[model samples]
Target: MNFGTLYRKSAFTDNPKGGNPAGVWVGETLPSGDVMQRIAAEVGYSETAFMAPTTGYYRTVRYYSPEMEVTFCGHATIAAGIVLGETEGDGKYQLTTAAGEVSVIVQNEGGVREAALTSVEPKYTGASDVLINEVLSALGWQPSDLDGSIPPARAYAGAWHLVLAVNDQNRLAKLNYDFERLKTIMLREGLTTLQLVWRESADVFHSRNPFPVGGVVEDPATGAAAAALGGYLREAELITVPATILIRQGEAMGRPSRLTVEIPATGGIVVKGTAVPIETE
Candidate 1:
């Protein structure tokens, strides 16, 4: 049972201790879903990326958490990009995922390696009043606690997330919720995570993702949610077109991460970040 050459990389930050760690496995053939799930559980990260080459610069990729498989994952993708760049040389890699096709470009600038991933066609849908109310109750937040400017919606950029913006940064910092109850709600709604955010400026925001459905309490840095947010903001006419935004996450967790989101006039959102190898003894 040869798994592959596994690399441990931290995404969205150069400092190994300050980013989300992901396991990247690049191999000749991917293992069965059950084996992959078990391997991910053993890795014990938020997500692990499994990649197998399909053709030139094209690969089949799958994502899995400790508990189950996910359609897509942003941080893990970034980690894989860095690994591919270091091992296979910097270039563009086309990824075929369960949700859609994604492309990741790996580059080295001034000795710093970075990767940019363009998500699948992003979109959003209105959140039902019932669902919103239930989520709010689970989070112990009132309607007034929400930012009226950004209405509730279910946003998707490969994976689905419930976007809920707050007016206060303090409110975003103090995150505590019913784990089992929220997990149940998220599973029932087919949600990957809750994109909880607080806007600091027109192009800067603070984000926290509750990934109960993924069997994690919180995600330090979430690229999928950030891409979804960029699309939702534009589709909802909250932000101007052809804009770029900065997402600061994982701060509260002490593993700070930064994700750069570029929103074009019309297309999939592009997420840029840097990943570094996590050397362990």
Candidate 2:
């Protein structure tokens, strides 16, 4: 199948170089799963989004990494939203993924397109001490590096993420881990990413995501993980409802990105950010 109109966009930042780059393909019909996986590998981004119009404002969307297909991907969704807004005008779009239905709202703010996506019903589960210890061992971190304020938990928005909070920002900044070891454990535990974070303030936080399962060393901006973190905070009673928190990420990797997470009193979390086209050489 001939894939059409491939776009490269950076999510979570207005600047092309400041966020995670994702490949977006808007085709009349989506290709086979194998073909989609091949195209994603050829594009060589963290994940690529394929969209085919269904009826009205609904589209069938699938996310693929270089290695395999993911159930849901937040950054790619944001990038696809920007692309849709640029082509079809700013509006709300309903997308169907393997996980479930998602709603994305896109707006053109002074020529810069920004998008917000309402996640599926979020939930959390306690992380066993053994699992947490294994993950920490893979990361070369000691138990004392953790922040006691927020206990370890596995959070899910669209995908499952292991939430680990560090007391020091420096520990979060320096992310070097045994990729194979981490990947083995994560695959066994059915985890998508390790959401390592540090609190800068009540409403500000810094995060790093290890995504070996997707064949990436780290993700600059992870919207799905951000949503999961928000759910964890709310479910654990760590934050007040009707709050908006800012997450600063990718600075350690030099691709600085920002994601805003909005938590209501009840319901799904909203993750919002801007996306810009990446200039190719």
Candidate 3:
């Protein structure tokens, strides 16, 4: 059972029970893919982050779900950042991931310590009609259920997500989907999660992410999806530039998580949140 320095932390919330729980393993050297996958599965979290020191202020990090290795994971990154800050010191750290280079800034604000991760260059593309129809069908939704303001698209920051905005918040709340069918379509399309959301205002939104592909029902706080949404809005010209928006998630699942997203005029998107250590026996 000995792997390395394993820490359990919840990301995107200061309370241990509010945010998404992620396993963070810090070691002198990264473990094999199979070992990492096993450890992640044993941890039984949505995603577990394995990181090892490489050089000054740089770490080699990889993410794994219970099912497979993920290209990148934002909440786990946030958890790892807090772990590093608590173990080392509060500062900036560069992470080398399969997706690309990501930088995290850890700081103490007021009485709480928080981490903000700047995602890799983000991009988005229109989703094919066939893909949209299949996904909607799997969710038992019609094309009329979608918000005309923001069209469906695949957005990527470190990982790819299918973004679908609904005009009604009720639709986002009652999230019932066919897990096997949706997982098939998502895996076929190489998607990480479905970013089902409802925009409340210009700077406020509600989101729910189905992560059947990750062997989880849903994600309480999806930093990758939130970062992707910020990028998508900026790139799609749906939101004004240099805006900071608040995303409220996980309420439906009873684990409320808040994600703060900062969108600049250009470059990578920034997602900020605080993580608290989770004590397990």
TM-score of model 1 vs. true structure:
0.98
lDDT pick, better of 1 and 3: 3
| Ten contiguous residues with the weakest lDDT in model 1 | 50-59
Question: How do the residues 30-143 of candidate 1 rate in per-residue lDDT, one tens digit apiece?
Answer: 999998999899988999999996236899999999999999999999999998888888999999999889999999999999999999999999999999999999999989
Q: Whole-model lDDT for model 3 versus the true structure?
A: 0.94
* Candidate 2 residue-wise lDDT, 1-281, digit = tens: 56588999999998888999999998888999999999999999999999996235799999999998988999999999989888898899999998899999999778778999999989999999999999999999999999999999999999999999999988997888999999999999999999999999999999999999999999999999999999999989999998999999999989999999999888889999989999888
Task: Provide the global lDDT of candidate 2 against the true structure.
Answer: 0.93
Off by over 4 Å in 3: 1-3
Off by over 4 Å in 1: none
User: TM-score of each candidate?
Assistant: 0.98, 0.98, 0.98
Task: For candidate 3, list the clashing residue pairs, or say none.
Answer: none
How good is model 3 by TM-score? 0.98
lDDT of 1 at 83: 86
Q: Which portions of model 2 miss their true places by more than 4 Å?
A: 54-56
Cα misplacement distance, residue 14 of candidate 1 (Å): 1.0
